[model samples]
Target: MITRRAAFCLPALLALPARAADWPLRPVRIIVPFAAGGPADGLARMLAEVFAPRLGQPVVVENRAGAGGIIGTGAAAAAADGHTLLFGSVSMTIVPHLQAQPVPYDVVRDFVPLGLVGSTPFVAVVPASSPIRDVAGLVAAAKAGPRAITAANSGNGTLSHLATELFNARTGTAIESVAYRGEGVLMPDLLNGTVALGFLTLSTVLPHIRAGRLRALAVAGPARLAGLPETPTFAEADVAGLEVDGWQALLAPRATPAASVERMAALLQEAMADPALRERIAGFGVLPASADRAAFAALFPEEFRRWGDLVRSRGIRAE
Candidate 1:
């Protein structure tokens, strides 16, 4: 009953287009800038375990480890596809500014913050025997003897050093930086009162704090940490803008598709929501990531700028 023109149109309408494939056609390689066997590397493996079976591909963490993470970060910056990701840290925002030479990538320009993992705050800690019991007390003591108070750090450009710099700037005090080979040597000095103070990683100092070997004055975070609820945040302690912590996160190359990034972010948040994972992370004195991706990403630029200014002004070097 169809007319000749109608019959001719029916064939064109009946032709079907081919289906498009799902994303991540192959294994996804996650680059960790630090060396293996470290806490960061351990966390990366934990995440990869969650991602691999569900991602429909093998998820691998590759440690590129050198130049304070510049080597692997540069490799991540050069990634051309969504399959390559970076399990970066607060160091990504820091190490570049510490370099006298220009880094291979710009933190903001080269990558987008994919998701937040967690952070271990820098606690203002003193030997249990010290008289200082709070931020005000610590500040007063430092002010009493300018440049006489010792703040321990593993090296010149580490987060501990930067936190000490920020604390000094915020409190209008000058505490001298005391460098150590690593925490192994530094912890003993702190225990024996050879070092008066340290803005140290909570995980590294938590046991000591709990064991009554070191006293935590204030935690550099938005609010009091669950592990140290009695310890107030810097703001609550009357020191605003003194928050300092080493955050762990994922970032993707900027050129990666927006859809893919969104999907990955959702996946990360879902993984972070696991109660067991959060508990495990918290057991190490690290706080679990919040569900707010936008809020977390919004913080990156400010933190990046803050650390950069401090690094440049302090003339921090890699050695």
Candidate 2:
């Protein structure tokens, strides 16, 4: 007596497609929230090229830089179609935590996390001629002359700035912070010794570090960098409570279908496993890191809370 109703429903369910087709029926646009030639832009290009073939559509990378990445991110947030996605980074997580007004987008509410692409550690460096040979010497100098040691970063509320602040808080030192439009623009001052110290990615300072123009004091991670094995980690350097690493990720406008999000995550995970892709990404000085949708999505709220606390305690304001 199960009846005709049960018999009719079974066949209808069986007729459903075994598996969904590859989405991205047309060209896809990836919005990079930074200018060309920068790390974010470079990562976006790499992702677009790698992701295109997987989705069977051309993936285009576009730079929409303004207001410290707010404009581009906002545009992506407002985009309803899944065709437009955002190449987000630490800035995306850190900015809103500092802004007085509510940010245009909610990291957890407005964006769907696709995956974590990778992370690169920043190195603490000093001019080649400086007597500060290691972390201890640099800390001693900063302690002796509060606010005398100046460190330059891309801008306020940026990873570099946060790195320095975290260092200061941990070491109990008062180091001055100078913010610039971008890391590229801050190089001249660093090379010329206008800035006494700098906390930047090893990629940004690799040439100089290899040229013997700047000496690496320590890396802001748990372990030493593969490229610079001799340099010690923040923990090894004995800098109390200091550990920071800059990262990049991919996000989509909220409300994208779960099927699409899962598809992107699976493809990205596959791409990350490709040896050739791994080599290329490592060449940029970032290790290729990937996670499934659930794992990646879990990180946003934690990051938002951590950065939010720092912003409130330090009173960081966007410039």
Candidate 3:
């Protein structure tokens, strides 16, 4: 059934992969949309250090931080060449939904998720001295006087803010959500009991929790974290729909070749297998990931839709 024209085209189709695989002709840059000192920056630097030599080119980590990472993210989206990649985070899905005007690019439409890097779950915490010892007690207290129990967040429209809102919605407690400039300011107030409760990252609150300044009531992850082994998950506490695992990933421009994307994802899996790197990532209370491209494809879009639904339902807007 092979026609003369079809036979002529078969050879060209077979050669496509060879052309697509010819990428990273020069140095590759991983764009960290956040500021220079945060988790994305640190992780990207670590990845660059491990992945550069094996890639047969230099890998650079560039910080294009601003507008809560939109500036850098937009820049990466416009990069048609395979040389530029994005060190993306939970904020990507949240930002577009929270913005008043539309952001420069659509995450799902403009970029292809390369692979998952890691994830950290938000933990619900009260001051060590709080009488709210468990999830039930916290909910009961918040319900008693919704105004009395304030939930502190890093800022409006952040994952922390949305987590707080999600908890309130699920529990039927209209607890006031307070915004701090960032976790640094929120931490001092949280320890001093100026803020009643906050759903914060373990990395930001783990030391304080260990020193007995913060009481971790429940974890909003699939299971209890290794660092906080004794804390129960929200579902275990009879509270459902509070799960939120803030994830990290790498993405490339949508126009990048499929072969290049697969190769980069393979490199990520290999790097994640490194014991030293895994230890370093875990030191910050993050779980290292080695998921393949298909997994990444499934995760990112669901996250995008999930956060969008929450933002719209809650009327969450950027600060």
Q: What lDDT score belongs to each candidate, Candidate 1 first?
A: 0.85, 0.84, 0.88
* lDDT tens per residue, model 2, 1-319: 6678999898888755333265776788899988889778998898888988778899999899987788899999988776788899877888877777887888779998888888888999988977889998988999987597999998888889998988888888899999997788998898888998999988888789999998999999878888899999888988856667687888888866666777877887888778887788888888788655677788777777787878887788876
**Best-first order by lDDT:** 3, 1, 2
TM-scores, in order shown?
Answer: 0.90, 0.88, 0.93
Q: Which ten contiguous residues of candidate 3 have the minimum total lDDT? A: 15-24
Better of 1 and 3 by lDDT: 3
Tell me which of candidates 1 and 3 scores higher on TM-score. 3
For candidate 3, what is the TM-score?
Answer: 0.93
Q: Give me the overall lDDT of model 1.
A: 0.85
Cα-lDDT of candidate 2: 0.84
Across 1-319, the per-residue lDDT of candidate 3 in tens digits comes to 9899999999998767534356668899999999888888898898999878888899999999999889999999999876889999988998999888999998999999888888987899999988999999998998896476998999998888999889888988888899998888888888888889999988888889999999999999889988899999999999987888879898999877777887888888888888999889877678888757788899899999999999999888887
Provide C-alpha RMSD values for all models, in order. 4.8, 3.9, 3.6
TM-score of 2: 0.88
Residue-level lDDT for 8 in candidate 3: 100
The residue-level lDDT of candidate 1 at 226 comes to 74
Tally clashes: model 3.
Answer: 0
